[model samples]
Target: MIDLKACPLWLYRLLPFLRWWPNVTAHTFKADSVAALTGALIVLPQAVAFATIAGLPPEYGLYAAMVPAVVAALWGSSWHLVSGPTTAISIVVFAAISPLAEPGSPQFVTLVLTLTFLAGAIQLAMGLARLGGLVNFISHTVIIGFTAGAAILIAASQIKNFFGLDMPRGAHFHEVLIHFGSHLTDIQPWVATVGAATLAAGILARRYLPKLPYMIVAMVVGSVTAAVLNARLGQEATGILTVGALAASFPPLSMPDFSLTAIKQTIFPATIIAVLALTEAVAIARSVATRSDQRIDSNQEFVGQGLSNLAGSFFSGYASSGSFNRSGVNYASGAKTPLAAAMSALFLLLIVLLVAPLAAYLPVPSMAAILFIVAWSLIDFHHIGEIVKRHKRERVVLALTFVGTLVDLEKGIFLGILVSLLFYLYRTSQPSIRELVPDPAELRNPRRKFVAKTPDTATCPQMPILRVEGSIFFGAVEHVQRHFRNVDEADPDKKNLLITARAIGFIDLAGAEMLAKESNRRRKLGGNLYLVGVQPDFCEMLRRSGQVDTVGEDQIFRHKGEALQAIYPRLDNEICRRCTARIFDECHVALPDGTPRAVADQREAEAALARLHAQGATAS
Candidate 1:
C-alpha cells in the first residue's frame, strides 16, 4: 500500500481525491451508494430537460451528466457538489451557438464542443494562476438578474413546442411573444392539453409529494395523456410530436473543431461561459461546504470544473457547471464524500440505459411544460422583491441586467457587472467625513466620547476635530483634499485641523501626498494639522511614500488624549482666551500661554451680575 502520510503536497493537489480516500470506510461507502442512487434518479429528467434547453439531442444531456460529473467530483474540493448541465449554462450555450448554426444541427453541436473546449482551457489557466477570486467582482445581483432573464428566454423558446405553433426556431424573446400573439388561433388543442396536464402534475407533485422526483411524475402523466388523445383521435388529427428513443449506448467519443475560424468564432463566447461557469461552480461548492462544515478551496474547484469541461468536450458533452439542485440533494441524502458524485454518474448511465427506450413516448409538449417549471424555479422571487423594495443600487443593477439579458444574453451580465463596479467606485471615492465634538455627557467620564457635531453644539474657534471613515486611496484623494480645504475656507479661524484617523482603513501614496500637502498648507497659514490614533498601515504608507517627515513625526500621535495634550498648547493664546467652548479638559483650566483663566472667569461672572442688576432697574 502507498504511504499516504509520506505523500508530497503536489500529489495531493494533483489527485485531490487522495485527501479523502483514507477516510472512506465501508459504512461511508454504503451511505455514498444510497446518496448516489438518489442523485441519479433526480438528475435523469433534469439532464433531458437541460439538453432540450441547450438545443441539443436528448442523449447529449445525459452524456453531460456522466463524465463531467465524475471528473468534477474526483478532482474538485467539495464532497457533495455535483457538476452537470444546469439551466443557466444550458441556456447560455444555446444562446451563444444558435446564431452561428442551426439548432440541433451537427454544425451547432460542433461549435458548442469548440466553445466548451475553449472555456475549459481558460478556466484551467485561471485556476493555475490562482485568480479564483475574480468571481467575487461579479456581484450576486448580476447573477440573479441574469438567471431570471434566462429563465424567461427558456420559457419563450418552448412556446412553439408547447402550443404547436409554427414559430421560427431561435427567435429572440420579443419576437416569440409577437408571433404567439399573432398566431393565437393556430394553437393545437391536443398539444396544449398535454402541456397543461404535465404542468399541473409537476406543480402538485412538488407541493404535496415533496419526497418524489416531480419531473418524472409529470413526464409520466403527460405521456399517458398524449397517448390517450392520440389513440382516441388518430395521430394525424391530434398532431402531437414525441422526443423519440434516445440512444442507449455509452457516450460516444467526439472531437472539438480546432480550426482558426472556429476558435475565433467561439473565443469570446467561451470567455463569457468560462467566467460564468466558474462563478456558478465555486458558489455551489462553497454553499454545500457551508452545510457540511467543510473548508472549500475555490482555486481547486476551478481546476476541477475546467478539467471536467475538457473531459466533456472529448466525451460528447457541452459546457457544464455545478447543479445546486443535485448538489443539495446529494448532501440531503447523506453523501459522505466526492465518491457519491462520481458514483451518481455511473448510476445515471445504468438508469439511462434502462429507460432510454421509454423516451419515445415522451411528448415534446410535455418536455416543454417541464422546462417551463424549471424556468420558473430559476427565478428567486423573494430575493428579487427584497432587492427591488429595499436596495436602490442593487435594484438598478438588477433592472439593467434583466433588460440587457432579454436583449442580448451574452453581454447583459457584463453590463450588469460594469454598472455595479461603477456604483461601488462612486461610493468608495467619497469616504465619510464628519466634524466631531466632545459629548457633554461623556466629558466627565475618563474615556471622553466624541459625537458628530451639531449646529447647537459649541466647537473651538481655532481647532476642529474631524473623523475620516474609510480607506484613503487614489480615487478618494481629491475628495479628502476638498474636505481639508473646506475646513479653513468655510471658517478662517479654524486653521488648526485635527483628524481622528482610527476609522481610516488604508492610505495609498496619493493619500499620503495629499496629507503632507495639507500639513504644509496649514503651517503656512500660521497653524498646523495633527493626526490622532493613526493605524500602523496609515503610518507605513506615509513612511513608504516619503511623506512621514513632510507630515512631521511630532504631528502624529498614538492616542487621542496624548494628541490633545500636545496640540492644545500650540493654538493662538488670543483665540483660546476668547473661546467659550471648553471642549477639552486642558481648555477648561488655563490659556495656551500658561496664564491662569481664574481672573477672567471672575470678571465675566461680575459682568453678568451687573448686566442683570441694570435690567432689573430698567424694569422698575
Candidate 2:
C-alpha cells in the first residue's frame, strides 16, 4: 500500500491508474465475473467471422479474443470495454493484405501479423506521447454516420451466405449487387429457411428470454432444424452447409514474419488497419463510459489497445479491436472493472478447449443470421432520427458515411471526419460581429436586467456600442475588419465606437493586426476606438503580438463610463455645444474646450430639443 502511495505526483499524472488502485473490491469482482461470462458467449461466433474476414484461420479469431481482451481491459480506462476482433478491422485487413498476396496463404497471414505489429507500435507511441486529442479530430457526427454505414455494410456482406447465393469471394459492393442480381434465380430455398428461422429465434429470445444467450439459442435452433432437414430430404437433396469442425486448443504462441518483403508489403495496409482499429476501440470505450458516467482517458485507452494487439500478434491472432456487442453486454451485465474483460478471455479459452469440436454442427447460415442481428443492434435508430430531425448537416454526414461505407469500407469513416472538420472550420472562420446598443430601458435600474432590445437611429449618437462574437483568428481577419468598416460607414459622424469585447472568444495575431489597423483608421477620422471588458487571453495576445503598440495603451477601457470619459474630449466641440443629446455624464457638462452650453435657459432647451428632433435622436 505504501509503495502504491509513494508514487510521485508527476508519475501519477502520466499513469492515472495509481489513483484508482484503491477502488477494487469483492463487489466489483462479482460484477466483473458475470459480465466477462456474457462477453465470452457473445464473442464466440464473431471471433470466427472476424478471423475469416481478416484472412486468418478459424482458431486465430479465438486467440485474438484471449490475451488481447485482457491486456486492453487491464490497462484501459473504461471498466466495460472489451477489445477483440471487430468486423471493420477485419474488412480493412482483408483489403490491405489481398492486394499483396492471395487470401489464406502463408504470405497473407505473415503480412497481416506484421501489419498488426506495426499498428500496435504506432498506437503505443501515440499513447505515450499523450496524443489522445486525435480522437477529437474524428467528430461525433462522423462517428455516428460512419457506424451507421458500417452497420449496413455488415448486413450487406452477410446477404450472400443468408441467401446462399453464388457471389465471387472478396466482391466489392457494386460487384456484390451485380453478382447477386445475375445469380438471382440460383437462391437456395432450404438455406434461406434455416437462416430466417435462426434470425427469428434469436430476435425472439433476445426480446423475450432476457436471461438466455440469444445467439447461442438461435444457433442451436438453426442447427437442429438443419439436421432434421438433412435427415428428411436426404443429404444430397437438402444442401444445407455447416461450419465444419473447429480445432480445440488454447491461444497458440505465434510468430510474425520480419522479412523486408513482408514489411514493405504490409506497412501501408497496416496503417489503415491500425487507424480503423484504434477508432473502433476508442468509440466503444467512450460509449460505455458515457452510460456509466465514467471519466475515460483516451491516452490510457490507446496504451491498453496497443498492448493488447501487440500481445495478440505473438499469440496466433490476427488484427483485433473493440467489439460493441460484447462491451455493451458487459456493461448491461454490470461489469465493475477491467477484470471482466480478462475473465472473458479466460472463459473463451476454456470454452474453446472443451467445445471446439462441437462447432462442426453449427451451420454457416446460422452464424450469418446471428451477425445480421448484431449489425442491426449497432444501428442506433433513435439517434439517427434525432440527427435527421434536428441537425441537417449531421444528417448529410450520416448519409454520406453510410453510402461511402457501403461502397468502400476503409474510406467511408475517413471521409465523414474530413467533412465534419470542414464544416467546423467554416463556422469558425466567420465569427459573428454585431453593433450593440445599450438596453436603455434597463439602464437606470441595473437590477432590472436585460430584455430583448435592438438599435435604431434614435439610439445614442455619441457612442456606437458593438459586440465582437467568436474567435478572431487568421482566417477570420477579413470578416472582423469588414464589420468594423461597416460600423462607421453607416454613420461616420457618430465619431466614437465602443466595443464590448466579452463575447470575443479568443484572439490570434491576425485578429490583433486587424484591431490595430481599425484603430488607426478610426483615429484618422478623428474618432476614438475604445474596448470594454477585454478577456485576459485576448489582452495577452494583443500585448505579445505587439498590437498594443499600434492601438494606444490608454485607449483600452474596462467599462462604458471610462470609455465615455476618454472619448468626450475627442468629439466635435461645435456639435456638443449646439447639441441637446446628453447621452453621457460628460455631455451634461461644458464642451471639451470648457465653454458652457446654457441648457438651463428654457429657450436654449427648446432649440436643443428641436435640434435633437431634427437629428432624430432620443433621450432616455
Candidate 3:
C-alpha cells in the first residue's frame, strides 16, 4: 500500500482511486460482489428502457452501463454511487438532438457522441477549477420539486409503450397527455395487460419477498404472461411487443461529427446536459453518503463523471449520470466500497454478453412497468409534505421547480434556484432594528439586560437606545437609515442616540458612512450618537472607512455603562433640571454640567416640600 499523504500531486491526480484502493479487503470484496450482482440485475432493464427513451438502440444503453460505469466508479468519490444512463438525461438528449437528426440514425448517434464529448469537457473543466461548491446553490427544495417533476415525466414517457399507443415521438408533457386522450381507442389490450401484470408483480414482490429483487420478478412475470397470452390468443390477436435482441459485444470505438453545423446545434444543449448531469450525480452521491455515514468529495465526483462521459463518447455511450436506483440498491445490498460499483459494471458487461439474445423475450411494457416503479420511488413525499406544511417560502420554490421540470426538464431547477435566491436576498436586506430600553429592575444587576421598550418602563427623555439585529451591508444600509430617520421624526428631543451594536453582525463601508452622517446630524441638533458593545470588526470598518473620527472615538464603548458614563455629562443641563425621569444613577446626582446642588440644599428642599404637604392636609 502506498502512502497517499506523501504521494506527489501529479500521481494522485492521475489515479484518484488510490485514495480508496487500500479499503478493499477480503470481507469487503465478497460484500461488494454481492452488491454488484444485485445492481447489475436492476440496471439491465433500466439501461434498455433509458436507451429506448433516448431514441438509441438497446445495445447502446448496455454500452453506457459498462465502460462509463466502471470509469465513474473507479474515479468518483462516493462509495456506492453507480453512474450510467438515466431517465432525465436520456429524455434531454432525445429532445435536444431529435430536431436536428432522425432518432437512432447514424447522424443522430454521431451528434449525440459529439454532444457528450462537449458536455464532458465542460464538466471536467469545472471540476478541475474546483467549482463543485456551485452545487450548494441548488437548494433542497429545488431538488425535491425537480425530482417530483422528473418522476412524472418518467411515467409520462413510458405511457405510450405501456399502453401500446402510437403517439408521435418527442412530444411535450401536455402534448403526450392530449395525444394519449385522443388515442384512447387505439390502446392495445395485451400490452396494457403485460404492463399491469409487471407492475402488480413488482409491488407484490417488494411487499412480501423484500429480499428478492422486485424488478426481476416483475420482468419475469410480465414476460411469462405475455408469452402465455400470445400462445393462447395467437400472435396477431395479442399486440405485445418485445425489446429486440441487444448486440453482445464490448463498447466499440465511435466517432463524433465535428462539423460546424453539428457543433452549433449541439453546443448549447451540451452545456445544459453538463450542468444537469453534474447536479444529478453529486446529489445522488451525497444522498447515499448520508445513509452510509460517508463523506463525499463533490469536486472529485465531478471529475469522475466528466472523465466517464469523455471516455464514453469514444466508446459508444451517450450522456450518463449517477443512477439513484442502482446506487440505492448497491448500498442496500451491502456495498462496502467503490469497488462494488466498478464490479457492477463488469457484471453488467458479462450479463449482456451471456444474455443479449434472451432480451428478445423481454416485453417492452414490462420494461415500462419497471420504470413506473422507479419513477414512483424518486419522489420524496415525506419531505415534500413537511415543506408544504411548515415552510411557505420553500413550498413556493418546490412548486415552481416541480412545475418547471414538468414543462421544461433542464431549466426548471434553474428557475427554482433563482426564486430561492431572490427570497434569501430579500430577507437578508431587511434586518430587524428594534428600540431597546434598560430594564429598570435589572439596572442594578451585574449583567445589564435590555428589553423591548414599553410605555410602562421609565426611560431617559434625552437619549434613546436602539438594537440592530442583523448585518448592515449595502443592501441593508437604506433600511437602517430609514429606521434612524423614523426615530428622529418620532422624538426630536431624543437627540442623544445610543445604539446597542452587539447584535449588528456586520457593517460595511456604506453602513459606516451612514452612521457617521447620522452622528453629524444629531450633533447639529445639540446632541450626538454613541455606540455601546460595538463589535471589533465593525469598529475596524468604521476606522478603515475614516468615519470613526467623524463620529468621535470617545462615542464608541465596550459596554453600555461606559457609554452612559460618557454621554451623561453631555446632556442638556436645563433638560435634566426639569426632568423627573431619573432613569440612570447619574441623573439623580447632578445636572449635565456637573452643577452639584449640595446635600444640604436637597434636605432643605425636602423640608419645604413636607411643610407644603402638611398645610394642604390641615386645609382639607
Candidate 4:
C-alpha cells in the first residue's frame, strides 16, 4: 500500500488537473487547438442529434457536451476520455424520462438534471469507498453486446427520418421496422431524396475525402437538396421538412429538482444510468489506453464522471457520458494529453457563440444520417468472432445481451452479467479428480507421471492413490464424494485410498466436511483415508472448521515417504505377510506398528507381485 502522506507533494501529484497543467506548452497547445477545433465542429451536429434522441431541447445536448466535459477532464484520470452526450445513454434517458412528462417540457428537463445529480452522487460515493472493483462484475462481452444492440436501435429510431417513413415515437426495433415496412407506400419522395443525399455524401466523403469532417459534408449536401426541393416546389407541395429554429445562446444556468417525490421516481433510473455511464467511460478509457499505452485509474474515472454529471446538473445539462467516436477520434487525432478534452469544451463554447444560428438550417434527415454512421462504428466484429469461437459459454451471454438491449436497454446489461456468472459457477462446481496409478518404469525414482489409463496391479497389496485438482467448495461437495466412492468401491483388495493433495487449489467449509465424513465412512469399511501434501491454508481451514480433529492429524502427511511410512503399519498384517511387492522405500523399514518386513517367505510373496507389476507398468 502506498502512503500518500509520506511524499510532501503527493496530493498535488495524484490530482489529474495538476498533472496536465505542466503539459500546456506551445507544441501541446497547437496540437490541442487543432483537435479542439475539430471536436467542436463534430460535436455541434452530434449534440443536436443526440438531444433529439434523448427527447430533450436541442440545446440541452450541446450544454451537456460543454461544461461536463471540461469538469470530467480536469477531475478524472484518463488523458483522452472526452465525456459527452452518448448514443446509448441518450436512448436510455429518453426511454426513462420521456414517459413521465412532455419530451422537452420544463418539468422534464428539471427531472433529468436532478437525475444527473443523484447519479453523480452515487458514483462519487462508490469511488471514494474504493468500490471501483465492482465494475469487473460487468463483463466486457456484455458491454459489446449491449452497444451492438443499441446501435441497431439507433438505426431503427432514425428509419423515420432516414426514408421519410412515419415511425411511432419510441417504437421497439421490430415495431419500427414493421411500421416502416407497412407504411412503405406512404414514403415522401422529397424527404427520402434529402435523407438519401445526406447518406451518400457522408459515405462518399468518409471514403474518399480524408481531410474534411463527414458530418459537415453530409449536413451541407442534405440541406442544399432540401433547399432546392423547397424553393422549386413550395414547402406545402413538396413537404421538404426542416428543423425550424434553435436558440444560439450559451448554456444557461439551470436548477435540479429536489422534491422527495421527484427524487423517489428518478433515483432508480439514475442508478441504472450511473452504472452504464461508468462502464462506458471506463471501457472507452481502457480501450484508448491500449492504443496509446497509457495507464487509467478506474477509481479516478468514477470520480471524474461523477463530478462531470454533478456540474452538468447545475449547468442546464442532462445525464451524459463518454462517446466512443469522439474519444477514438481524439486519440487518432494526436491528442497529447487530457487537456485536449478540456479544450474541446472551451472551443465548443466559442463555436456555439459564432455559428449556433447555422443549426436552424441543418435538416433532421442530415442529423439522422450522421447518427447512422455513429451507430455503424460501435460493432466490434473481430472481437465478436473471437469470443464466439474461443468460448462457447460466453456466446449465450453475448447473444442474450445483444437481443435484450433492443427489448429493454436499461435491464439488458444486468441480465447478461447475471447469466455470465451463472455459467462460471456451473463450470467450477466439479473439480478434476483422476485415479492415479504409479508407472512401473519410475519405480526407482518415484517422480514420474501417473498413468490413469493403466490398470492397477496392486503392487503394494492394499493402498490406492488418486490426484485431486481444483478448489473444494460448497457446490463441489457431491462430485468429490463420488470420486472417493469410485476409488474405494473399485476392488476389495484395494481398501485404503491415499489422496495426493498437492494439486488441490483451495478448500472451504463444505470441502472440509466432505473429507471428514469420507474418512469416517472408509473407517467403517475397514479402510482408511489419508491426505498427502495438503496446503497449509487448506489445513488451517480444516482446523478452524474442526474437521482436522475428525479426520485426525496423524492421517495427514507432508510428503509421500512420510505418508507411506505412516500408513504401512495400518495395512492388514495378513495381506502384508503374504505380499510379494514391497514397492516403497519405507516398506523396507519397520512399519509404524513395529512390524518388520516379512522374512524369507514374506519377501518371496511380495517380490513375486512386484515383478508382475514391473512387467505390466502398474501399482495400486
How should the candidates be ordered by lDDT, best one leading?
1, 3, 4, 2
Q: RMSD, each candidate, Å?
A: 2.7, 4.4, 3.8, 5.6
Model 3 segments more than 4 A misplaced: 1-3, 291-293, 439-441, 451-460, 500-507, 532-540, 551-553, 557-620
Task: Write model 1 residue lDDT over 463-498, tens digit each, in one string.
Answer: 889999998999999999999999899999989999
Ten residues in a row with the worst lDDT in model 3? 595-604
lDDT of 4: 0.82
Compare the candidates by TM-score and give the number of the best one: 1
Q: What lDDT score is found at residue 284 in candidate 2?
A: 84
What tens-digit string does per-residue lDDT give for candidate 4 at 291-327? 8888888888898899899999999888888878788
Scored by lDDT, the top model is 1
User: Of the candidates numbered 2 and 3, which has the greater lDDT value?
Assistant: 3
Q: Give the alpha carbon lDDT tens digit for every residue of 249-328 in model 2.
A: 87777788888888887776666677777777888888888999998888888888888888889887777888887899
Give residue 171's error in model 4 in angstroms.
Answer: 3.1
Q: How far is 515's C-alpha from truth in model 3 (Å)? A: 3.3
* Counted clashes in each candidate structure: 0, 0, 0, 6
Winner on lDDT (1 vs 2): 1
Give lDDT: candidate 4, residue 285: 91
TM-score of each: 0.96, 0.89, 0.87, 0.84
Whole-model lDDT for model 3 versus the true structure?
Answer: 0.88
Model 1 RMSD in angstroms: 2.7
